[model samples]
Target: MQTIVYQIKDAVYANLTNRCPCACTFCLRAKGPGVYGSPPLWLEREPAQAEIDAALDAQDWTRYRELVFCGYGEPTERLDALLAAAARRKALDPALRVRVNTNGLSDLVNGRPTAALFVGKVDCISISLNTDDPDEYLALCRPKFGPAAFPALLRFAREAAQAVPEVVLTVVGEPVTDLAKQTRCRALAESLGATLRVRPFENGTRRFPVP
Candidate 1:
């Protein structure tokens, strides 16, 4: 069966939809079948709310510290469903922290302020900042929303900081190893009142090949 929810380290990641706005050149999906040895990250179709509930209900929730709304796609692409799943998880265990790993392009994708949607439901919001310059971000991310996507993403990050307890802006280390660039990116995220997370780039060596 396709993976709807899978474990990685101390977190449980939910694969709701294989839908995303940006097509980053360094995306792990470009290199393998799945992030870890669970199942193909792809879904035949986006999972329904009932499917999400059943999956969450089946998990040994106490074994994990975080329930992350992330997979091969941008979780906020289906914001309502994401929120509902998060609320369900929270209801199941109020102490279970819920997070969404996103491209920060939801406002551009949905044409509205999507940050407020996560207010009380999500404990942390991790947005992919990618770069410090707009042109470079546009070139690398290739978001369907066009050049305007960069600023819209920053705006969403700032808005999310006010709603979620922990708001993080992330960059892939491989492409952002320059100390100066990383420093600038960190400063930029700090300016928006969000923490910067320089995540190690996965080259898919840890990924299992599809049969």
Candidate 2:
């Protein structure tokens, strides 16, 4: 019998930066990082590839159910480092399931389509669709730029739908309780052949524990 050894699934999270386009009303970091379970959200400098590699190396990848990319800020902002880590992890275990929890706004940030780059490397892409209504999205998201940032996020998800095998369009449970918006999000994701996952808003929730 081949014994399989797995490290407890590492529910690991990474903070790539403290910058984001949308300043959602529900953001825990809006006030500051240490406010909640997050100790401190401040990053003096973006760590180099070596630093990221070293951090990930210290982890027992086999123990975790999946490797997740998420933080107080947007993970895709560090596209180069992320891709390198993804490639390294995949090389180590092709069967490893790699996932990214993103706001899905990289295309707008990088001024180009960035989803295609995830092929083969990322096993799944879960993005925050947040709200179906552009106006409400703008209101809650409080994006740093113009109102256009709202739809751009949706478009990013749309583009990822065709690129990633398991694309998830997710929204938190709240003002989104509007049946119409829920229906719209579900229908749109279904039409695009992507899965729609509705997650509860993590507001004031206890720190996520490892399973």
Candidates' C-alpha lDDT:
0.83, 0.69
Worst 10 residues of 2 by lDDT: 1-10
lDDT of 2: 0.69
Clashing pairs in 2: 7-63, 9-64, 10-64
lDDT of 1 by residue, 1-211 (tens): 5789999889898999898888876667787768767678888888999998999899897789999988888888888889999998888799999988888888987888988888779999888887899999888879888988999999999999999899998876754456788899999999998999887754445221110
Q: Give the TM-score of candidate 2.
A: 0.84
Best by lDDT: 1
Name the weakest run of 10 consecutive residues (lDDT summed) in model 1. Answer: 202-211
Displacement of the residue 63 alpha carbon in candidate 2, Å? 1.8
Clashes in predicted model 1: 0
